[model samples]
Target: MPRGFYTEGSLARLSREFDVFGPLSSDPEPWMTAELDQHAAAVCESITRDAGAVTLQNLSSYLQGFVDGCRERGWRSDSAGYDWETLRLLAVCRLAKEHGFVR
Candidate 1:
């Protein structure tokens, strides 16, 4: 599938657009929310501590677990679930890119 098929533009655009929908309150889906935050934090910490070794590929590999987890939670056929996962991953990747983990 082509990129942006999920929405229309970039993940950043989708994130901004999602905000108009409403605030994302805490839900029972820990794997989709808090788990994503924790994973992002851990990835950032690792990247900061070892910038030389933490590449985008490394970050991507780590993120795959989160993606898989999200899929298990409900990302398969749900647009909302896909959006949440995409938003979380984009935020994490953006941070990694800023820290030089990605080009």
Candidate 2:
């Protein structure tokens, strides 16, 4: 992700449940690794927030589409690395679920 492409404002609501780490920068330094994990955890938590209310079959289907979208967008590329891609995918999944665009 580009610097400032995702801002603290985008994650304001998530701050209550998880640390609001800024998005990956254009030339992200190694120090950002910790924040990346935090961001991913937040996204995962948010995406799974309604897990109990959602059917396993539906959740699995949604998850497949979510991961496929990420891969199609190159969010899962080796260039982005495992951690970065993990966070990116989780974040997108969370946002999609929030908007009712995904399960």
Candidate 3:
């Protein structure tokens, strides 16, 4: 299995750090070395298709749009919180590299 692209960019590091240090901390170590999951991959595909292409130059904008959309509806319920925010960052980084957007 291939691992996701590991960019040394601030966005990538932010995701990993948030995942490891956030209140709902998760083990991103496995995600770092493992193949991208189907769900994330599928989301990435849809985003790429819908957005017409995501590159490092615009990744942050996409991230902002995601957060804005989430906030527009509801980012949290009783069961979940901001974990999806961090996960989306990680997922975007993963596919960004996979799609050669990170270079």
Tens-digit lDDT string for candidate 1 (9-96): 3434433443333133223255555655675676667656756465656665556666668767766423444455565655564555
| Best candidate, TM-score | 3
lDDT of each: 0.51, 0.44, 0.51
Q: Judged by lDDT, which candidate is best?
A: 3
Model 1 gets an lDDT of: 0.51
Work out the TM-score per prediction. Answer: 0.41, 0.31, 0.46
Model 3, CA-based lDDT: 0.51
Stretches of candidate 3 exceeding 4 Å from the true structure: 1-13, 22-36, 76-86, 96-103
Question: lDDT per residue, candidate 3, 10-102, as tens digits?
Answer: 655645544444322434455443433643565656667877666665666666676568667775322233245445655665655566654
Write the number of the candidate with greater TM-score, choosing between 2 and 3: 3
In model 1, the runs with Cα more than 4 Å from the true position are 1-42, 46-53, 76-84, 100-103
RMSD of each: 7.8, 12.9, 8.4
